[model samples]
Target: MQELPGVGLVERARAVAPLIAREADEIERSRRLTPSVVAVLIENGLYRALLPQSLGGAEAPIETFMQMLEEIAKADASTAWCLGQCSVCAMIAAWLDPDTAQEIFNVAPGILAWGAIAHEARSVEGGYRVTARWDFASGSRQASWLGAHVRIVEADGTPRKNADGSPEVRTILFPVASATLHDVWQAIGLAGTGTDSYEVADLFIPERFTAFRDVPAALREPGPLYRIGTGATFSLGFAAVSLGVARATLDAAIALARAKHPSLAGTAMRDNQAVQGLIGRTEGDLRAAGAYLYATAHTMWRDLCATGEFSAAHRSAVRLAATWTIHQSAKVVDAAYHMAGATAVFRSQPFERRFRDMHAIAQQIQARDTHYEDVGKAILAGG
Candidate 1:
């Protein structure tokens, strides 16, 4: 399928937007993306967008990948959320042993996904015996491999510490089949993400399959993308997804306003000065937020390319921009949903689903108001 591609990654993503949109109902019903939709994503190279070139991935620029995510998200937030999870997990390949990384990511149909929770792993001969039930394992149904972040401990239950006195934590890798998945993703938003819980019982993860996530010194791929760190990449990708969801909801509202007429209004909603003003103002807000996010991301990337290092200031700026973008995006979605009136209350329409999804994105830690405090602290410290 990769060989038949005439258009680039971004073009392919744009072309599949309709298919993704068409699958939203099925995705919502199944609590996971269907096989057909997953096929479209894999065929389009969306899952491999963030992987390094050395590992048979596109190694596309971060901005390009973010745009692709935004495009997918505009069609379906769940699919975009799952794609973001897989793509971000793939970034770990840049830090894994070259041979191990290649074998894991170069499968016939590439797959990678992981949960964010840290489990417990006991240090043992040649590896660690890990045990934990991880929640929010997005894309697990479609993933070939899964990971668990674990804190290393002695067999006697004492925590292992590095020379600097920091608790030793490592991300352990295993096949999806090795873990048990529990159907717990009963959320109002992103219901199709299949973000269920997975458990592994005393599984032995060889040292080679585990690595420190977001550690720049251990990276095997020297691209500037990895240098920006995993956390920042997540902030950027999810922010893009939030923005995309916002744009789609706003567009749906505009379409409804232009066509639907209220009982009291003689003209269509578009003719209503209040509705006109809402659309105009919301459009400006989304655009400005998007611009801020993209500009901040580009600046960070450029700094990485120029100096081979992303300073503390760059990281702080990314956090700030992503948090601001997500909050603003939620506002835009709220405005659009409210303006859509009774039409938005129906489950069949696009506005309702996007309204739930945008709020869910806002509730995530990346969008927390405390992120503003973190950035403020960084600035005060002269980052």
Candidate 2:
């Protein structure tokens, strides 16, 4: 009921921060957002921020959407992760048939979750039949639709190939009920993301419900947001989540340092020169990383809007900024956790959960240090 109409989506996300913060404990314990929080997210239009406007969605700019994720993440990382998963799935609408896309996203929840599958889909008369178990299906608990990325094959089990002589891969969509959900999301961090593994056997997927998982030229929408492509959008948005979690952890640590006295030290942590220096330097580092992330995202978004295409430099810059931001955020969280001392290790303290969550984020593929090599290669190629 606390809807703030006429405000930007980022501001709207900020408005829900208190509620998300209040539910953080329950979310972690239950391994999913509560129904009430889900309803609030739906009512606030948070899930539709990345959807095409033609389908009753916001069609928000990439920067705005990433900022919104940051605001939500400051309250709870799991919630922010789920929001990112669902919203980015909506972006796939740009490649879907209008009728099918509308039908899938127009549902009440309109959330889609999926995972990687090693299985191959055997082509049939009208569609393909897939039997595979996908892992890391984040946000699956509340999704309306589910997807599986499969390699296409012929009836005799030979892999299908595109005109360019590459193996054809397609992401086939199916109703959430068609897949059997497994309650194996037990994780030390981001437990509330509900990133469970799912199974689908002999599930029939019509051709219209599938598309090339990474082909940008096939997108149906002409908006710049879609033009940026899913890889860049996910990297930037997830990096913002890392930054937000780091921001919250640093704030919490500062609060504890100012109030509690260390047993070994005669004075409070805030009075200790070492603690002071650590927090000060870490804050500066976080701010610098955040500035780079946002600046790169804004530049890419702007360039795509004006030119309808992104240069190799722009793509490499986005990936480099994201990888750097994630690593820096993890460092900030580690410093904050150490500064909090014994208090940080307790579940009663925010640093404990954030420390675990930040590490998990760093382990994601997008946050890997190898991305630096990709950026370096791009620079060399360009030069």
Give the Å shift of residue 340 in candidate 2. 0.6
Off-target runs (Cα >4 Å) in candidate 1 are 1-7
Model 2: per-residue Cα lDDT over 1-383, one tens digit each? 64322237998899989999999999999999988789889999999988888787888877788899999999999999999888887888888989999889997778888875567899998999988898998889989999888899998899999999988988899999898999998888999999999998898899999988558778888778887777788899899999999999999988998888888788877889999899899999999999999999988888888898877778888999999999999999999998888888888888888898889889988898789988887778863
How does candidate 2 fare on TM-score? Answer: 0.96
Please list the residue runs of candidate 2 whose C-alpha ends up more than 4 Å from where it truly belongs after superposition: 1-7
Q: What is the TM-score of each candidate against the true structure?
A: 0.96, 0.96
Residue-by-residue lDDT tens digits, candidate 1, 258-323: 889998878888899989998999999999999999999998888888999988888889999999
- Root-mean-square deviation of each candidate, in angstroms? 2.1, 2.3
What is the lDDT of every predicted structure here? Answer: 0.88, 0.88
